[model samples]
Target: MSIGERIKAKRKQSKLTQTELGKLVNVSSQVISNWERGYSDPNHDDVARLAVELDCSTEYLHGISGDKLSSKDVLVAGQEINLTTEELQLFNELKKHPVMFHDLASDPEKKVKELLKMYKMKKMFLEDDEELGDGFGDLED
Candidate 1:
């Protein structure tokens, strides 16, 4: 299907009016209409928002068969990073993994931070054989 058709389908599946979807994605209803009519396409930021709001991938929105941005290609705000398509594909694969979204969603940085903290906690607990209080465990649960 065309990107327009896919967008329409996603929007409908979300049970959102054009206006509502536009609001969520920060665009005007008429802009959404134009997109549905294939008159124009969303820019990268818009596409990113659309993918998030629709729970789909930018690649999918672009009519490419794949997942969203990869982990390595993603940089913390103020960090310099560049990502190739292949890296993005790998990132998407990681994002699609069963437990990966547990980190990808919410705060991606938080996910990494929690993982590191957990690793350290695990090492400390192992050394002392003590039960650590809830931290990353609580977030996952």
Candidate 2:
């Protein structure tokens, strides 16, 4: 699919109208419509914002890669942080939660730490549950 198609698909998948997405990107709905219609493209900053809002990599949005979640390590604060696709999806879900909506703006580092902790805890719980076999085998009558 083309970039415009990708953007439109992602926007719809995200359940955001063009006007809402434009507001988030600080542009008018007409601009978003233009982008969806392939009449114009967003600038670099807007593209980055769109990627974040869409919970996808810029490469996916740009149609350079078919993968919505990259498998490679990401650079943050000059450090390479490796994460699996599931972990990345968890992180994205956490970042989009209402409780975390303002955390990034107030303190991104703290938010990252918190998200990492949550991800680890979640992974551990899932592992433990799997080991327990249906998570109800230990229940007593």
Candidate 3:
């Protein structure tokens, strides 16, 4: 499915309106609408945010691959987030390949999408800054 379709699906599953998601991701509601309609594509920053927020990867957002990480994999990757004990237990039970978890507190689909957006945004932002330099590179010249 397209990113727009994926976003709409996740948003509905999470019970969040486009405006709500836009607020969380620091975008306008219209921006979300535009993205969902394919009227515009998200910039790298937005894509990153969306991926983390969606708990997928930029590649997944771009539809490069449809393989989603299992809940345990998501939890493992999210170790730094300091998930709750319940969350950890849930992940532990769900981490094996062909992953499945019963009674997840959060909808895995939406949770993964959101997490992916945050992860992608953070990684992309840092990479972009590094590539652009600190803007003080010529200060000594």
Model 3, residue 28: displacement in angstroms? 0.5
List, residue by residue over 45-112, the lDDT tens digit for candidate 3: 98888777766666667787685443334432323233545554544444553333334355655554
- Per-model root-mean-square deviation over C-alphas: 12.0, 9.2, 16.9
Per lDDT, what order, best first?
A: 2, 1, 3
Which consecutive 10 residues in model 1 have the weakest lDDT in total? 71-80
In angstroms, the error of model 3 at 19 is 0.5
How would you order the candidates by TM-score, starting with the best? 2, 1, 3
Q: For candidate 3, what is the TM-score? A: 0.49
Error of 2 at 136 (Å): 45
lDDT for 103 in candidate 1 is 38
Highest TM-score scorer = 2
lDDT of each: 0.70, 0.77, 0.67
lDDT of 1 by residue, 1-141 (tens): 777888898899889999999999889999999999999888899988998898776777898754433334455332323445554554455545556345354556665445545555666778665455443455643
Q: How many pairs in model 2 have backbone atoms within 3 A of each other, for residues 3 or more apart or on separate chains, i.e. clashes?
A: 0
